[model samples]
Target: MLRYYGVDLLDHHRGTLSARRVWVLLKHLPRDSAFARELHGEESAWGLGEHLLASVIDHLAIGNWLFTSAHTAEGESPPDPPVPVPRPGVADEEDETPAASAGEQDLAWFFADL
Candidate 1:
């Protein structure tokens, strides 16, 4: 069933598989039947718990994606990326005050001793 939907378990575990695709496949799982039993295997199987957990995670991801997609589908543009705030006492390029020098600096001074 998973393979039919291009969901490789390894890729899913690594988060490389698409959650929407997995959700589509999972939602179509047979309901309460011998075939479903055979597909998922015996309830006593050691891997059944892992499979169930994966399904739950996929559903959550899909739900979040759908929620965001719904807003865009309704003619709303996605929010813009956040703009960076200037540090205090820093001067803008157009101002007469000297702008901070551009270079890599050691950040160890910013932290307190553990």
Candidate 2:
């Protein structure tokens, strides 16, 4: 059976690459390879600098797509996974009613002009 994955670019300002190229690069990530060097080498080609490239790698690492290490050159292991960020509009488990779903609160405003 074949498997497929998807990558959505939320931040359009970062970089650009053909879909094929992106796929090819991500294909190497599973092996726990040294991706930082490859990214740094192709930084110019990808139209991103060290900081931006690191950000991309960090995002992938945080998303669990790839493992990364700051001291990989010295044979250190991949760092711990980054903390997951909460998405906007996602209510915490404890919050019974989020701001958007504030029941009956907006009804007063709705009938104010009526």
All candidates' lDDT scores? 0.49, 0.43
User: Distance (Å) between predicted and true CA of 33, model 2?
Assistant: 47
List, residue by residue over 3-27, the lDDT tens digit for candidate 1.
4455564675587866565555555
* lDDT for each residue of candidate 2 in 2-100, tens digit (9 for 90 to 100): 122344432222555454455454454432233322333322133235456667766876656343454355665666667544433345687764333
Report lDDT (Cα) of residue 105, candidate 1.
Answer: 30
Model 2, 32: alpha-carbon shift in Å?
42
Per lDDT, the best of the predicted structures is 1
Q: For model 1, what is the error of residue 110's alpha carbon versus the real structure, in angstroms, after optimal superposition?
A: 65
